[model samples]
Target: MESLFHPTGNQHILDRIDKLTPIKLSEWGVMTVSQMMEHCKMPLQVVYGTKHIKVNPLIKLLFGRRAKKQFTSAHPFGKGMPTAKEFKVNFEPDFETAKRELKELVEKFSREGKEGIKVTDHPLFGKMTYEEIDVAQWKHLDHHLKQFGV
Candidate 1:
């Protein structure tokens, strides 16, 4: 897996972010390019321990493995996939600001390295290791970048 912790892989993500424009079109989903950028930050925050969202025990027990598999698999996330409520962006977002924030968060994650990531149960993916978080984060950003054809 291409981890954001890897310098080249990290630059790949930042480059994609740089390629986005306020008027960029999405190949799928309802988010404007800016909204998608903001939405993408949610996972980083969650993994960084800056955001805490509780996962219902039953939901995690029933769907965690399946969700984890889908997220971390080589296949791109299918169009119009469901998002956790916390990750949803409702208002118009400033394109540059959103892009900058996402880029900063990505860099912060890379600096933290594997051991720096605090182990926590993902809101849906259950308990995840730093390696799992690395793969999941990269895949999530890649999916959105591809969504906007970046």
Candidate 2:
């Protein structure tokens, strides 16, 4: 899997993000480009301890590992997958602001690399290693960027 920890993969993601514009429509899913950019930041924020998502205990126990495995695997995320409510952007976000913020976060994640992740236990994914986090993060950004047809 391409990892954000690697320079080339990181730059690829950043370049794809730059291709997004305010008027860009998703090839699939309901998020506008700006909203999708904002949504992308949520998982990274959780890694940095800047955001928290409360997962149902029962749900986590039942499906967390399986979901995590699938997410971090080489397979790309399918279109129109359900997201956690916390990651949903209900209000409009400024396009440039969201783009700038997402790029900044991506850069920060690349700079700090695995050691930067403050949380190893994902609420919905149970325990995760640094390698898993890198794959999951890259996959997520790739999936959303593909959504915008970038």
Q: Evaluated with lDDT, which candidate comes out highest?
A: 2
What does candidate 2's lDDT look like per residue over 1-150, in tens digits?
A: 677888888899999999888999989998889899999999999998999889999999998988998888999888878988889999899999999999999988789887789999999998899999999999999999988898
**Which runs of model 1 end up more than 4 angstroms from their true locations?**
none
TM-scores, all candidates, are 0.93, 0.97
Least well predicted 10-residue stretch by lDDT in candidate 1: 112-121
Error of 1 at 147 (Å): 0.6
What is the model-wide C-alpha lDDT for candidate 1?
Answer: 0.86
Colliding residue pairs in candidate 1: none
Winner by TM-score: 2
**Candidate 1 lDDT over residue span 40-101, tens digit each:** 99888887778888877898889889999888777778788898887889999999999999
